[model samples]
Structures are given as structure tokens and as C-alpha cells.
Target: MTFDPTLFLPDDLLERIRERAPIHDRENTFPEQDLAELRAAGYLSILVPTERGGAGLSLEQAAILQQRLATASPATALAINMHLVWTGVAKVFSDRGVPGLEFVQDGAVAGDVFAFGISEAGNDLVLFGSDTEATPQGDGAYSFTGTKIFTSLAPVWTKLGLHGLDTTSPDGPKLVFAFIDRTDAVTTSDDWDTLGMRATQSRTTRIDGAVAAAEHVVRRIDPGPGADPIIFGIFSVFELLLASVYTGVARRALDLAVQTAQKRTSKKTGLAYSQDPDIRWRIADMSLAYEALPPQIAALARDVDEQADHGALWFTLLSGTKHRAVTMAKHVVDQAVLTAGGGAYFSSNELSRLYRDVLAGMFHPSDPESAHSAAASALLGPLQG
Candidate 1:
């Protein structure tokens, strides 16, 4: 009980749950009391494994407790950064014994294991593909009829990781998962209204027949070298927890752009754009990129947890620390929404939902084409360490 990564955010509760990010992005809602106060203060099992109680962190102490819970809600740290990458790929698929290893109740989270069912239903959300079809049945149980789109938590999750295709062993696709105890086998359609993390209900799950067991289906066994870049897999700790939840929504849009330039007054030099010097160099220039993106993504997640089985050099150091912390959290949340002027897009500004939850770490899964082809094969190696 004593591993304090800012105890998952406590300094008057991270500026009071970052003032509830503009009413959970204007009711596209689902912070659910900031994820039930970050899973009732266990801080969502920080990499769930110390023989399954967890806090066995070390993806550089779970990227400093996911950059202190994305400083305070980068859309609930990108909807709980895929529950620390589905519990670190379910603790390396339960130490390689692999069959399902279903331990989410290690202390009942009730939701989280976060989304990415690999898009379907007339797919084309920018083409990094998969179809998800699974239907196998003849007494080993299977029935995952697809349509599962974006799926960031079909109205609250309880662990999920599904990618189907199995109408009874018609092979090559089977990673199944579910603890969904009937949302009637999953159904959600309102295509996650987008343009940003908008409270990240990132929806669309629709399964009709989500049955499980064939030991709840767990088949992603990459001992390595599918040319190694899965950013070293579990999406490189979700691209360093989506660059520390977009550097905690660019440090809460640089503290609401330095409290709206010290409470406005500048109708052209009527002064007090916090005594402008180019709005105090864009609010002290996003506090030096929020104090240097949590120590360079905690030293590249401690060199990928000290070479966790060197999976292609921890997928080229978690894809060059998520391409330099999502290109420095997109120039520190677009210069904290232009030092929050034009009332930072008034939906009752909170730097307009930290300028839309810091652009969900700019095309997450550490975009920029797998961080420049894993930094050009880790500075050009004959790499496979």
C-alpha cells in the first residue's frame, strides 16, 4: 500500500478532478465520478501482477502512475488506458500458460481492461485493420457475431478484449474475451460522436451473441519477430499511456491557460492578459511541456521495464517513448488552446475540455506510423535483442 506515484493524484484531488473536465465533455459522459475515484483508490491495479494483487508497476513504475492519472483525466487517461494494456497482456498471458488466465476480479474493478476490439461494422476508421467474426459452436462454446466498432467501453466495461473469426475453427483469428454478463451479449450503436476524446465513451460495441469460454478465448502468442513492432506489444503500454494522457490534458490546458490569463481584461491592451508578453509566452510555454513530459515518459518507461524479455528492444523503446510523448503532447495541447483565448471555445471553458481531452494522445497507439518505424529499427540495428 505504499507506492506513491502522486498516490494516483492527490493535491486537492488533482485540481478537484480537473474540475470535472467540462461536465465530462458536455455529457458525452463516462468519468463516472472519475472512474469511481480511480477504482476506489487502487489506481486501477497499476499493471496488475505481483502474483495478481498488483502495483508490480515498472513500465517505469507504470509510467509514473500513468503520468499521475493523466495529470487529472486525459479522458480518464484515455478511458483507463486499456486497463494498463489489458493487464499487461494479462500478465504475459499468465506467464505463458496462456489459456484465458481470467483474473480481473483480483480485487473487483467492475470495469476497465479498456477498449479496441479492432474496429468492424463497415470498417475504415483509417485502415489499421481486423474484422472480428468468431462463431464456433459444437460444445466448446463460441458465438461472437461481429459489428464491434471502436468500443471504448460499451457504456461501462467489466474487462473486454475481443477480436473474433471462428465459425468453428475456420482458423487464424481468435482472441476472445468477456465478463460482460449481458448487456444482452453487448449492443451499442451511436457511433461514438467524435473529433476528440469527448468523455471517451468511445462507443459502438454491438455483438448480438457474445458467448465465451473455450477458456474465454486467449490466443495472441507472439514469442516475437512479426518484425517486432507491436511497439513491443500491449501497444507499448498504450503508447506510454497515451503520452501520459496527453500530458494530463496538457497540464489541464496549462491550468486553464493560467486561469484565463489572470482573469481577463485585455480588449486590446486594456491590460491583464496576464500582463501580456505574448500571453506570457503562451502561459509560461505550457510549463516547459508540463515539466518535460513526465521525465521523458519516465525514462522511456524505464527502458521498457528494464528490457522485459527484450521483445525487439522493447519495441524500440516503446516506440521512441511514444514518438517523443505524442510530439510533446501536440505542442502542449496546441499551446494550451492558444493560451485559452476566444474563450477557449466556450462550452463554458475548462480550456474547452482541455481542448477536447488533449486530442486522445494524437491518434493513440503511439501514432506517426509506429514512431517512425520504431525509430528506423532502433537507430539502424541488426536488432532482435
Candidate 2:
């Protein structure tokens, strides 16, 4: 059967999201209405299997949908990206015949919202290590106690998939991956005010002895990077979806630039700016930058879906793709702002909002510095000890 994104997110829904984006950005509030609409559309479960009562879409399809959503509302798309990451991980597990995360798929089908709580302040070794502590309860359950920063979907997530260090385990130290429901032990801070993507309200969460039931505890692997499917699943899905969001931002910026060029007339030439060689060149430059990302994202996403063995080159490719998407999106948006001229300087201008929102790409996982380091190591081998 053919999978159509519009079947789930029709044009009217996207138009509504686009109209509300600026309001959400101005108010700095979570997009509750958007979330409600997306949930109704079963968007949160797109990555779940068909038998599990979801759209049963592949990671590649999900990436395409994310890009479309981001073009309408980047914050809404970014907030939902966290939920999709968890479901995408569950899909990863199912594809590999791994057990234990079936519950996540079921939860998604049952309308549960999952938030990514893996980020930490000052934890440069993301996905490889952790500062949060995960103590075992003698049974299979574990108690998590630590603070998680940038906890997206903070105002609404029913469950949080996070990792913490389990130091007292017999294996010395292991990174415990688990899920915990919102309880008294979890305190969400009301401090999500930011320069952009404000509607995400990705506030700080302090987990004070939050318990993951025995069944919810998924993995306990040694820290500092390995071939664990859990790690690979999170990193792969997170990077690609993030890249999709930024790519959508670039697409929207390009469209706006073209529209402005065609609509605004040049006083000097008595013609539309689109007719001017310099304006045409700027728009063409933006197009060149924007055109490279979607296909790159599509190829990498397809590799993840097919489980293509890029082997050690996987991280290099994934991180590099994300880095390129963000840089290209920023460049396109900058050109767009230039093309749009003084009117774009207003806060109400969509291009102005995009300019602020695209900056967040730099702060997500696989920053340019890390991306470069990974590429360098992939080519030159690790620095000598």
C-alpha cells in the first residue's frame, strides 16, 4: 500500500500549524493544541508496527513526514521528534528481533507520549556515558536520581526514556537505559524560555528517585560507546529526524525568499526583484544549498531502514549528514533574510522567526565540532594515546 503523508497531515492541518507558529513563538508556550491534533492523527505512533495499530511507517517515511511538519511549524515538529525517536527505537528493536521494547510500541499505539531524557548539562560524552545515577532495587527494577536538561515535551510526556550510570552493579559500571512514568520523584522546572523553538518548552527535569519498574528497564551496557542496538537506535533516529526538521526550515525559507523576490518590485529597474541578476543569484544560491540535504537525509534514512552495514563508518555518516543539514539550513535562511530585505527584520516576519529557530540546530546532538572530530577519526584513526 502506498503511504501518503497528506493522508495523516492534510494541507489544512499544516496551514493551521503554520498560522499558530508565530503566536506560539511570541507567547513562549507549549503547543498543546498542536499536540492534541497530531495525537488525533496518530502521528505519535507512525513508527510503530501495523499489527500494533499504528501507521507502521518506516524510519525513512517518518523522516519525510518530519520535514513536512517542520516546514509548517518547527517547534511542533521538534517537540514531536522526541516522541518519534522513542518509537523509532522500538522499531529498531523489532526489526532486529530484540525483545523488551514491545511495550514501547504498545504504549505509542495506546496514546502514550514518550520524551527523550538522555541529555545532561556538561555531559560531553552523550550516548556514551551519563551523569545521572541508576541504582538497582535488588529486583529487576532500578531507581533513577539526577537532573536531565533539555527534556523536550516536558509539559506533557507520559513516559521518559533516559539513561543513568549504575555503579554498584557487579559489572563495575554500566549505563542503564530505562523508562519512568511521571511521579512525585519527577519535578519539571518551568524554565524553558529560549531564543527560538520556544513552543517546545523543553524544560529541565529533576528525577529524584524515580523508579523504572522491572519490566521497563531495557538495557544495561558498559558505558563509552559500543555496538549496542539501543545506542545505535537512539543516535540514528535522533540525528536523522533532527536533520529533517532543519531541512524543512530551509525549504520554507527558500520558498519565502522566492515569493518575496517575485512580489517586491525594484525601484531602480522598474521591475520585480526576481528579474534582477543579483537577487536571482541569491535565490539560486539558497536553492543549491537546500537541494543537497533532502536526498542525503533520504539515503541515510533508507540505510538505517535496510540495516545496511556501514560498520564503523555509521557514526561518521550519520553525524556528517546532520551537520550538513543544519549548516545548509542556516545558510539558506541567511540568504532568505537577505532576499526578503528590511521587512524580514520584523518579529512578525516568518523569515525572522526561521532565522531564530534554525540557530537551535547548532545545539542539537552531533554539533559541527563533534561531527568534524568523528569524521577526522574515521579518516585518520584515533589520536595516539
Candidate 3:
């Protein structure tokens, strides 16, 4: 059966979300209402197994829904992406016969919001390493002590899925992946001011000996990137979903450009801007760039769903797709702003807001530099040394 995204995220619900986007952006706050409505709709559990009281959608289907959600509210989609990443990871684990993250899947079904707490300032190693300290409590529990930056869903996440270096283990410097609750030891800083994606309110988090119970301690693997299923799950889901959101941003920009071209009339030509040769060419160029990404995103997402072994090239393909989506989104928004003319320069204009929101794409993981390096390594092997 072909999965229909509209069944989950209908147009009316999306219109409501779209209406609230500007308000959240203007206030620089989290989209609480959007979260409530989406939670009510069971959107948070779309990746969990149907037997577990979820939509049981594949990663490919989730990507399509994410793109649709992003078209209505990019910030909402981006914030929700963090929660979905954990559930998606759980699905990945379950599908591969891994047993640790069943709690994550169940938590999502029970309405527990899981935040991705892996990002740390100055820790460019990302999943490969962690600056945080993981102190084992002897009985398999671990206490995390470090500050994590860009902790999306900071304001409301019920559990945090994070990584830290457990140096005290006899195993010798294993990266411990665990889930900790928001206790008194955990502090969420109110410092999420940014140029765009403001509605996310992705505040910084400070963890001072926040402990993950024994059952919540998921993976304890050696660092520096290997074929761990957890690593593959995180990287694939994160990169593909990030790409899907930005692809939706590009789609919205292209749609706005078309609407502008059809509505705005040219004084010189005495016809709609759509009839102008230059404007038509610009729209066509935007269309060309926009048309290429969804298929790539869909293909990679399906490959993940079917567990198609892309082997060592997985990183390159994932990162490159993300890079292309973000860059293409930025380009389409730039053209949309040009097409809409000076009116779009105003802050109230949706095009202007999109112009700001799309700038955030370059900063996500698998950034252009990292993507190019992975691609280069795939093609020409690693640099000597």
C-alpha cells in the first residue's frame, strides 16, 4: 500500500501550523501549540511499530511526511526532527535485532519526548567522540557531566539521548550512549537567540552528573566511527531527515516564487511577471534545482528502509544529499526573494522569513565541507597520513 502523508498531516492541520509559524518566529519561542496538536495526532510515533501503537511508517514515509510538515512550519519540523531521530534509531535497532532501545519506542508511544543531546561545543567529532564525561555507577548506570549545545527540544524533552566518554571502564575509553531524565541536575539555559529557525528555541543544556538508569544505558562502543548499528541509525536518519526539511523549504520557496510571478505585474511589459522572459527563466532555474533533490532524498530514504547496504559509501551519499538539499534551498529562496521584489525585504513578508530560515541549513551536520571531504575520500581514498 502506498503511504499517504495527508492521512496523518492533513491540509487544514498544516494551515493551522503555517499560521502559527510567523508568531513563533516573531516571539522567538517554541511552537508549543504545534507540538500539542502534532502529539495529539500521533505524529511523534510515526516511526514506531504499529503493534506498538504507532503509525509504523518506514523511514522513507517519515521523510515524506517531514517534508510536508516542513512546508507548513520549518521550525516545527526541525524541532520535531530531534524527537523523531530517537524513535527512528529505536526502529533501526529493533529491525536489526538490537535490544536496547525498546524503551525509546515505547516512550514515544506513551508520549515521551526524546531530545538529541549529542552535540557539544568544540566537539566536531560529533558521533565519533564526546567531550562529556560518563562516570559509571558500578551497577551499569552512568552519570553524564558536561554541557551540550544546540540541544533542540530543550524546553520540553522528557528524556535526553546523549553520548559521553566512559574512560574509567576496564574496556578502556568506550563511548557510552545513554538516556537521562530532566532532573534538578539538568539545567536548560534560555539562550536560543538566532537569526532564524527561532521557533525551535533550541536552548543550551547543562548536565551535572545527570544519570541514566541501567536500563536506559544503550550502547558502550569504542569511539572514532565504526560499523555500529547505532551509529548508522543516527547518521542515516539525521542526514536524510535534515535533507527532507530543507527540500521542503526549497519547495515552499519555489511555490512562493511562482505565486509572486503570477500576481505581480510588470509596469514596462504591462503583463504579469510570469510573462516576462527573465522572470520565467529564473523560475525555471529554481524549478530545475528544486526538482532534483526529492528523488535523491526519496532514493536514499528507501535504501535505508530496505536496509540496502551502501557500505562505506553511505556517509558520502548521505552527506552529499544533505549538502545538495541545503544549498539548493538557499538558492531557490534567493531567487524567490528576487522574484518577489522589494516587498519581500520587509520582515513581515513570508519570503523574507524563509530567506532567514533557509540560512540555517548550512550549519547542520554533514555540512558542505564535511560532505565534500567524505565524497573526496570515497572517490580518491583518504589523504595520505
Candidate 4:
């Protein structure tokens, strides 16, 4: 059952992606070519079942492949994460005998791209609350109206998986999770200008009267966090995949540092920097931090696939893994940039782009604060209020 992860990421194809990454970043454009090739390669349906005409890869396998993809281009991996999150959630639901998300499975098999639209401005109650309003149509459908920020894959996502608040329901205020296809009512803003992950084209999205049909309405749950399968599916899949990408970034940075250390020579000593004690120590330190992440990701992802219960500790494990992966990636890239010397300071350098790309990790869900809170809660119980 164990397969080589590298087999999913052929070096020649990855080299093409890697070559275009900088150009996409420079131009502040989406990786259209990257998306095309990945779609052609059936990567968009990695989580869909074999019966659904997909590769039928498990979450652990998908995580490994994501890490490999990120080593070539982090933005591409991150953007694609949105689509995979939906498919992964569908897989989770299907595995648990949950209904209502069959659309995701069907869509992915048909080559549809799904974008995550759970984030909102100033709304930190992620998965528990929403600023967008979902008006009940009384026939199982709902019309959503609000702006979704950080909508990755904004340029080409065929369906958006988002949540909104439904205050009109007789059941009182409930968070509504649904899928909306791209329609005239949905608008994507071209305001994705940023310092990192620029190739994602994760622009602002405005949905005005965007409706999720009766069948597309997936979950209607109470507005705060609880033991909801949808929430668990989202958090587990998102965190694991996000962590995988950053882990790949860390590995790439560590490898680059090794290569730089070996190639750069010290003019005064007439020896390669790899021979220097300080350079060797730095590389060793980076490697030390980098080595622990892949196993952690693989183990956690396998646990998810096998439905292993970590109980209330699930959030802690997921968030902690993501936090550590991002933190380690940043540290490794810092060392790599230092090892690459002044040339890396240029905007065109791969290390420079990576240095910027890694920063966006801190901004994702289960952020540093949330991760610390989850860990603290797991260890000592929730802080006495």
C-alpha cells in the first residue's frame, strides 16, 4: 500500500512549475499553466473515490503529494489547497456516512475547482460564526450576501464552499454551510496585491444574492463550535494540507541551504562554506528542525484517514502541527537566505520569493494565537473564565 510520494510529482513537470512560479509572482497573476497541468494530471480529484473516477488517494498520500508540489511552488500548492479542502471534507463525510456533500465528490470527478470561503474580515470565530447573511428560501435553499476575504483560487474556482449566518430560520440563528456555483451575482475583486503568495490570486469575493440550491445546502448547525462533523472535516483536512505545504517549503529551504553551503567558497580560507564550522552548524540546525515535520504530518494524516480519535485533542494536534511547520519553514528559509548570501536579497531570487511565501502561513487559520490557545486548552483545560 505504501507508494513513493515522488512518483506523483515528476521532476520534469515540477521543473516547469518551478520555472513559472517566479514569473507568476512577479506578474501578480494566478498560475494558470500550473493549474492546467495539475488538472490534466488528475491532481484536482486526488481525494475523490476510485468509483468516482479519481486516483482515490488517502489523505496521507495527498499530504505527501502536496508537500512535494510545494517544494516546487508554494503558491500553487496553497491555492490548490482550497479545492482539496472541499474534496477532503467530502471524503470525510462519505467515510463517516454523512450525507449532503455528494456534490463535492461529483464535481471534483468532473474537474471542478472548489474554493474555501470560510474566512471573513474581523470575524475570528472561524467555523462558529459568519458575517455573511444567509436568508432562508423556505425550500431548503438559501441566498447568501456578504464578502469573503482571502478567497484563494478566486480566478478559476467553479464552486465556492462557504458558510453564512441564517437569522431568519425558525430554529434561530444557525451557521449555514453550502456550495455556490460561480454566477453573475458573484464577483471577484482584483485586490490581491500582497508581498507573498502573490501567485495565488486570492482576491476578495463579493456575493450578492448568490444562492445555494436546496440540494447544495449542506449543513445548518448552531452558530458556535461544537462536535460537528463538518467543522471537524474542515479543520482536520485544512490544517493537515496547509501544514504539508509549509513542510515542503521547509524541506526545499533546507536543501537549498545545503546546496548553497556546498557551492559557495570562502575567499579568505579558499574552502567551501560547507567546510566552515558555522555554516555546517547552521545547516545542521535547519535540518534538525526540518526533519521532524514530515513524519508528524504523515502520522496525523494517516490517523485522520483511519478515523483514529484523538478526542478533544484533535484541534491541538492539527493546529500545533501547522504552527510548527510554518515556524520551522520560516526558520529554515531564513538560514537558507543567509547561506545564499547577497544575491538572495534580490527580488528575483527563489529564496526571496520563498521568504515571502512562508510569511503568509502565519496568517492562515489556526493562527499562532489560535494554535497556542488550542494547545493550552488541551494541556491544562480551558482557561478559567
Candidate 5:
């Protein structure tokens, strides 16, 4: 009845996610049960309009919910983010009265899982340029052919929201943003083995001729970045949700560090490690680094919900927030591990997994380099050629 995130994502559900997280990570498997539970709880429809039979939550609410979810299982939260991104994008467009992605919202309510199929190997021009070919069918259809790497939700996605280059179209050199149903032409490779976030199962996808029907094509924008509503929506939602997940990871790690410090008694001090000045200081450092992220994510998400435009500055702010959240999460986790001592160094330790998971933050979109570049461009100006 209410829009309370905690009500939707209760502690009991989170406890289940937390309990199963290690098993999924160790098995290098997708958290199918987590997906099932979330789906049953209507989590997948959080961003859909209430008129469309969904929770109709704002981005700020979704961000907070995702942070709570991530505190239980970062991999599950990250995996589901691909789905949420599509719904969030659709919500953004609908909120702005641009009406085309209604089907995305509708499909989410119908229990369709949407995978984000944008990342390509060595393609740093994320969401701007694409190596995938969108061969036009002359009848308002396009058959995409390319290898899309890091395709999260690979095993269970019902639809894929992707972008590709349409070089031979009448509108030549346009980037086609569309959603294609999973078909025989699409192949998911079992190549998700990685350093961490193993439960994500973000495998490589090889597409020979994935077709997007006329009604499914959402946007046709010029190659390279611009002020397209679709692009802005994707960037805003993606970065904010991402920042929230890593921020949650930091929170979990910080809590674990405190627990370890409080429970463990030091031989020299004859008291709990929490009393040790160095341990306390390290925890404080982790806290100091961790505390500023949630309010920032909340404020920016509120801005998005309110349609408060910052024009060209949005990219800088969004990317910078993601960059800061990730970097800060990693720093906090590092300090947490230090405070946790030798026990955390063991592979079986939760702190050890958190350390590995936090490392993955650097690799997502708005990498440190890109974030700095965007921020610099915003503050100073684009670097002289």
C-alpha cells in the first residue's frame, strides 16, 4: 500500500539473500532462487507505473532499495540491476512524457527479464558507439549481429535491451537502440568465470541475427554522445544504481569490520580490538569514506525524479558520483579488511569476498579515467586537441 523500500525489501528476505550469497559465489552460479523471490515480491516491477500494475517507485526509492538488497548479496543486486536499468530507463522516458518504452514497463510487470546488452569487448565508447551491426530489413525491422560481452542475466533474460550501429540504413550511421526478444539467433556462452561477482553469471552473448520488430525499436540517435533522452536516462539510472550497489558493499564490509573488532580480544591490550586506537581509527576511516554516498545518490535520484535538469552537467555529476562511490567503497573495504586482521585474508572469510567484490567497482562504466575526464570537462573544459 505504501512506497516504503524496507517494506518491499524486508530484513527477512535480505537475510535469505545473505545466507545464500556465499553458496552462489562459491558455486559460480546465478542466484535463481534470489531471482524467484524478488520476482514474487514484485521487485522487478518497482519502476513500472502503478497504472501498469507495478509498485511505481521513484528512482530514489529504487536506489535505496537496491542498496539494501546489495547489503545482502552484491552479486544478486548487480545481476538484477541490468533488468532494473531497462525499467528505470522506461520510467524516465514515461516521466518526461516521451512515451515509447511503455512495453518495457508492461513487460516487466508480465515477469519478463530484460538484460542489458551494450558492453562490447574493448569498446570504451559505452552507450555512444557500437561495433554490433544492425542490418535494416527495409520494413522497420533490424537484425543485429555481433558479440556482446558482459551480458548480465545471460541465463534467464526474456528480452535484451541493446544498441548497435546501423551504417547501411537510410538514416546512415545511426545507433539503433532497441529491445529484442530472446530467440534461436541469440546464444549465451558460459564464459562468466571471473575474479569475483561470480554469482552474476554475466556471460558473453553471440548474436547472429537477433531481430527487433518495428514496434520495439526505441531510439535512433547519431553516433557519439548527445542530449538524447534515451542516452541521458540510461546513463543516469545505470550510474546511480551502480553506485548504490557498491555503497552497500562498503556498508556491509564496514559492519563486518566492526563486528570483528568488537568480538576479537587483543593479547596486548587485554580488551576487544574495538578499543585499540589503530583499529578504531581504521574503522573510523572506513566510516568517514563510506558515509557520504547514500545522501548523494538519494539527492541525484531525487533530481532525476523531479525532472530537475542540469543540462550538460548531468553526465559529469552522474559519472563523478559513480566514480566516487566505487573508489570510496573500495577504500572502505580495504580499511575494513585491515581492521579485520589475518582472518579476513583467508579466502573463506566474508571480508575476503567483499574485498574481491569491491575490486570489480573499478571496471564498471564511468571508470576512474572516464569519470575524471567527464568531471574535468565539466569544470575546466574538454582537453585541447
Candidate 6:
């Protein structure tokens, strides 16, 4: 992934999305229109490789476009997170790496989506969790019965990648990536209606007696790290992507305030609210925060592109960006409310819609507390011999 500064988001498509954002939010429907537009624009298959029949867009471009999407509707961007995450994993499995890696390479190239069943009811699904179960079954297949909470995009996924704990092994918990065909499993409880990301469709996914053969499962040559790096990496991606979404929401808030002020004038002063000094400064400050966010995240994307390894460099930049994004959310939109004044409080205004949407960023798993800890660990000098 190259760090190209000239990169910009698909503005026209995003503007159309912005127009329909209110309806999507109001009706609590998945951003079907937004997803269609993204798919039509070749965004749904972004992580898929060029040889495989997908865009294979660079990290930088993906980030730019995702952020743009967030500005229109963060929930829509979130719904696609699982798709993109699994797409990356599929590519890795297809690529030449680890022992017995030759398998799935062709399928990956051909394009297949996988949804990870990682988190259980009690497990830290937000962070990578160690939840797996396996028992040998007839015909070299095994039954997997595990409860996974917060399974985003599970409703729309066909391939199920269950991260299970293989208890048969004496070596602690052997984390295995089990692949199950969608036709084999059932969503015990598929009802998903949420408070914030109303349209994300993040339902509780269940796989009872789903059988996946040994060949379908792909474990690392050595089971390198304890957990799937992709899942852990998702937290990092969530931070950046959600941050962009939050920033976009804030941008919309500012836009709404400006538009509201333009249409209304002070009856007492005979002047438009936009012309008022107080209003000018508020808009100025809001714009300043919005301008500051994209560059900060763009810089982080560049750093990630340079450092492929999810080591110190990636951790530092990614966690730091999450922290910065949360701060920016509080600063930009909170103040934008003041700028919009009394009008924004009314449910009729777009500002009210953005007000709730922008706040969703703060509640993501990458809260300031955990992010700060990661940042501090990164800053701490490696212990000298």
C-alpha cells in the first residue's frame, strides 16, 4: 500500500449517500442504497486481490474512501467491516506463507468471504478472544458449538471462520481456524437491533453441530501467534475507520449549522445568523477540528503502509490515531452543537441526526483508557540488557 497524498474520497457517491442518510437513520434500515452504490463503484470487493477479481485498493485509498463513507453514514461503513476484514485474511491464506499454505490460495484468488466466530458471550470479543471447541466426528469432520457475540455482518456472510479452542492438545489451548460452509450452520438467535449502529445488523451468531472437515480448516504452519493477527488487527482498523466516520459526522454537523444559519435571520437585528461574529467563530473552530482529523489519520495510514509487521510501529501509530480520533470527536461535534445554537436541538434539523451519529465513535471498543495504555507501552523504551 503506497502513501499517496493526492488520494481523495469518492465525493459524488458519498454526497448522494449523505442525502439519504437521514432516511436510513430514521427508518433504522441497513444502508442498502449505500452498499449498492459501493458495490457498483467496486468497493465491496476492495480487499480482494486484482488477480482474484476485486479492486485490491491500497490501504491509503481504502481509508480515504471509508472515511468519506463515514461522513455520510458510519453505520454503513461499519456493516462492511467484517467483509473487508475477512477479505484480508482470505488474501493472506491464499498468499505464499506458512507451511501447508498452498491450500486456499486458488479459492482466495477466486474470491470468497469469511466471517470469524471469535467472541463468546463472556469473552472479550472486542479484543481478540480465545474461544474454540473441537471434537472429532465421522468422516474426518468435527462438530463446532460455540456462542459468538457481536458477530457483525454475520447475517450476510456465507463462509464461517470459527476460532475455536482445540482441547485435545496437551499444549494449553491450540487455537484453530475452522472453516464451515454457511449451508451447514444455523443462526440460533439472528435477531439484531441495536442502539447506535441501528443498521449494522450485528446479531448474535450461533453454530450448533456445524461440521467442518480438516481440509476446510487452515491452521498456521506453527500457529505463530496465539490469536489470529487479522482479528487483533481489526481493532486497529476499527479505530481508524470509525474515527473517519465520526469525523464525517462532525463535518455534516458543521454543514448543517451553516445551512441552518443561512436560511434563518435574527428578527431583532435584521441580519443572518451566519453573519454574526459568534456564529463565525464557532464555524471556524468546527472547521479547524474537521480539517485536523483527516491529515492525522492519513499520516497513520502512511505509517501502516510502510510497516507491514504489526509490531511496535503499527501499534504506536494505530493506537495513537484512535486516541486522537476520540478527542477530535468530542471537540468538533460538541462545539458544532453550540454553533448550531437552538435550531440544532430540534429533531427536524440534520444536526440532530449527526449529533447522535458522531458520538458513536466514542463508544467503540478502542476507548481512551485502553488506547492510552497501548500508547504508553509503545512510548516506554524497550528494557536495556
Please tell me which predicted candidate would have the highest lDDT against the true structure.
2
Alpha-carbon deviation at 268 in model 1, angstroms: 7.5
115-192 per-residue lDDT for model 6 (tens digits): 556657655433444555665564546677777776665556666766665566556345556678776565636576
Indicate the TM-score of model 5.
Answer: 0.98
Tens-digit lDDT string for candidate 3 (1-385): 8788899999999999999999999999899999999999999999999989898999999999999999999999999999999999998898888899999989999999999999899888999999999999999999999999988888889999999999998886999999999899999999999999999888999999999999999999999989999999999999999999999998998999999999989888799999999999999999999999999999999998888999999999999999999999999999999999999999999998899999999988977889999999999999996
Q: Which sections of candidate 6 miss by over 4 Å? A: 1-12, 89-116, 125-127, 132-143, 188-191, 212-235, 308-310, 380-385
lDDT of each: 0.63, 0.95, 0.94, 0.93, 0.93, 0.62
Q: Give the per-residue lDDT of model 2 (tens digit) for 1-385.
A: 7668898889999999999999999999899999999999999899999999999899999999999999999999999999999999999999989998999999998999999999999999999999999999999999999999999999999999999999998885999999999999999999998999999999999999999999999999999989999999999999999999999999999999999999999888899999999999999999998999999999999999999999999999999999999999999999999999999999989999999999999999998899999999999999998
lDDT of model number 4: 0.93
TM-score comparison, 1 vs 6, better candidate = 6
- Name the better of 2 and 6 by lDDT: 2
TM-score, each model?
Answer: 0.35, 0.99, 0.99, 0.99, 0.98, 0.80
lDDT of 1 at 229: 26
The weakest ten consecutive residues by lDDT in model 1 span: 222-231
- Model 6 lDDT at residue 60: 54
Candidate 5 lDDT, 1-385, residue by residue in tens:
5557777898899999999999998999999999999999999999999999999899999999989998899999999999999999999999999978999999999999999999999999989999999988888888899999888899999999999999997668999999898899999999888989989999999999989998999988999989999999999999999999999999999999999999999888799999999888899888988999999999999999999979889999999999999999999988988888888999889988888888888999988899989988989988898
RMSDs, each prediction?
Answer: 17.7, 0.8, 0.7, 0.9, 1.2, 4.4
Instruction: State the lDDT of candidate 1 residue by residue for 1-385, as single tens digits.
Output: 6567676567766666668856776777777787777777767776666656666565667666666666666667777776666665554445444445445526334444455565566544212334555666666666677676656755777656665554335453434434334457777777677766777687877777777666555553222234322213456566676677666566656766788789888787798788989889876776876787678777766655554465456666665766666666667667867776576677676666655655555465546776677678777865565
- How many pairs of residues collide in each model? 5, 0, 0, 0, 0, 3
